[model samples]
Structures are given as C-alpha cells and as structure tokens.
Target: MGFWDWLTGRDTPPPAPVPEVDPAPTEGDILASLDGVDQLISGGALPAVVRSRAARVTRLVRQTLPRLGSLGLGSYDSYSVVATATDYLPEAIGAYLRLPRDWADSRPVENGKTPLLLLIDQLDLLGATMEKIYDAANSTDAAALITHGKFLQERFGHSPAADLNVPTPPSGNSPDPFDLERP
Candidate 1:
C-alpha cells in the first residue's frame, strides 16, 4: 500500500480465502477440491504460469480418477497420498488469487519474488507431488525399482572413486615396463 492509499484507508486487497477440507479427505473429495480450483482459475484472469499449473492440475485430476478406480478407492494408502498431494492445492492457489494483478505481479516480499512468482513456484511443487502420487499408483514393479534404487545408492552414494584408494599407474618412465615381447 502506498502512503496515499494507506492515508486514505485503502489497504491492498487481501488474499483470496482458502477452501475448507474434510477431516478425512477421500478421492472424491480431493477431486472435487481440484475441480473447484480449476474452475476458479478458469473463471478469473490469471497469470500465465498460474494458468499452466492449473491446467496441469486439472489434467492430473482427470488422469488420477481412473487410476484411483483401478487401485481401489477404498485403499487407505492411495487415498492418503492423493489427499496429501491435493488437499492444499486450493489454498496454495488462493494465496494470490484475490490480490490485485498489479500488486501480485509487482510487489516483492521478503524473498525478493513477487507473489505471482511465488504462487507459481508453489503450484509447481504441488503438481510434482501429484505426479509422484500417480507414478506410485501406476508403477508396475515398485519393489524392483526400489531394490535397484537402493543398490545404486549404495554403489554411488559415497565420495569420489579416488577416495577408494585404487593404485594409480606411475606417470614417469619406470625401470620395468610391460613388454609384449616378454609376454
């Protein structure tokens, strides 16, 4: 808020209100929340990045429905993951939804990014979480993948190969060198 606006009692617009969530959110509940957010994004003007993330969230919701059906909607684990990933989406979007476009786009907070940019980044993270949930549901050989992942981690998770102390060949001329004739 500028000095004049503050003096005039015109404070900057407050953020959009976040939607409420159920205590134990189900797949349907999660999807409904996503649909609500999608509609909100569509109905109003939004930044390009926000629009893109909103579109992705909608697409993910569409893709998730069938997977949820196949994975067993009653499965607590799947429901938990979906709920965890999507439950906060509306609030994340809402944080900047009601702010004036000029303020959202131009005003920088303590992090040095405008509210619009921060919202985009937050949506990106949530979108990735949703994708991971989909991947977990669709995984064909999760056990195998996990085993391999652990193996790779054990093999390469440490310091560089030089730390292993494998002997290095002498760089300068040596008294005795490998000779094909002797062999």
Candidate 2:
C-alpha cells in the first residue's frame, strides 16, 4: 500500500506512533528528501533533477525571505551556483541562470524597488508558498490561530485588499492546439 493509504487508515493501522520522536531534521536529511522528490518530478536524469531542484530552491528562498533575515545570502549564492554549473547539465543550468534576470526585468518597479520583488514573483510558485505555510504553521502563533479568539479572527479573517482582482493572461490570436485536435 502507498504511504498516503496507510496514513489515512485505508490500508492498515499506523504502526503505533513511536513515543515523542525528534522533530528537527538535519540539513542533509532535508536535502536527501528533496533529492528524492526532485527525481520523481524530473525522472531519473541528473540534469533534470538539478534543474527541477534549483527551481524549487529558488522558490523556497523567496517565500522564506521574511523569516530568513540575513542568513539567506549564502543559501541564495549556493542555489545560483547549482543553477549555473554546466559540468552536469549545461543547457538546463543556463536556463536556470537566466530565470532570475528575466523575472527581474519583467517585474514592475516604481522607485527602484529591490530585487526582493523578483523573489516575491518567484514565491508565486507553489513550492515557495507551501514552505511558507509550513513554517508559519509551526510558529508560536499557530496555537493562537487555532483557538478561538477575537483578535485572531479580526486580523486574519478579513481583508479588503486581499480581494483585489489581478489581471489575467491575454488570449492568443490563433486557436488552441487542443481545440484543433478535437474531432
């Protein structure tokens, strides 16, 4: 049975929860887990794995910036290097290196806003959002949010700005390939 099936009690009772295990995972462990997920997402090819993980790591840097403070500097550089190394996958690496610049140029800026804007755009990727959610949910505020409280409800429950509509992608002049394929 799959891991999810077992966890949801569809396959078998979860082996009795081991009493109070360590919650913190080492960096090596985290990277190993990421590597496995990268492989699954990109097949067994090393180049594909590197490209996929670099994209994921870039997203992670963006979403965690608020929490990272100054520690993100080295992490950002390492990710960039991984994205640029051509010995493994020259084309993929080149593509990854190009992303930050392209994303930067495309972002709107009024008065010399920092590159953080580009990072925020990167955070729009799902992996970054998921990381932020995970980090936030683990903080001390998690319990406060879970328990009923007026402050919590007022602060997080409603925001007019949150409802603002963003522009959508323009439709293409040509018919979609999928539409043409239909009988």
Q: lDDT winner among the candidates? A: 1
lDDT of 1 by residue, 1-183 (tens): 789998887876788999997576655776777778778778767877688897786677567666775466667646744654465667777778778879889999858999888888877876786687677667745767888878987998874565889998887865455665653
Question: Which residue window of length 10 is worst by lDDT in model 2?
Answer: 81-90
RMSD to native, candidate 1: 18.4
The sequence of per-residue lDDT tens digits that candidate 2 reaches over residues 88-119 is 22343333345565454455554565343433
What TM-score goes with each of the models? 0.54, 0.22
Best by TM-score: 1
Collision pairs in model 2: none
Worst 10 residues of 1 by lDDT: 76-85
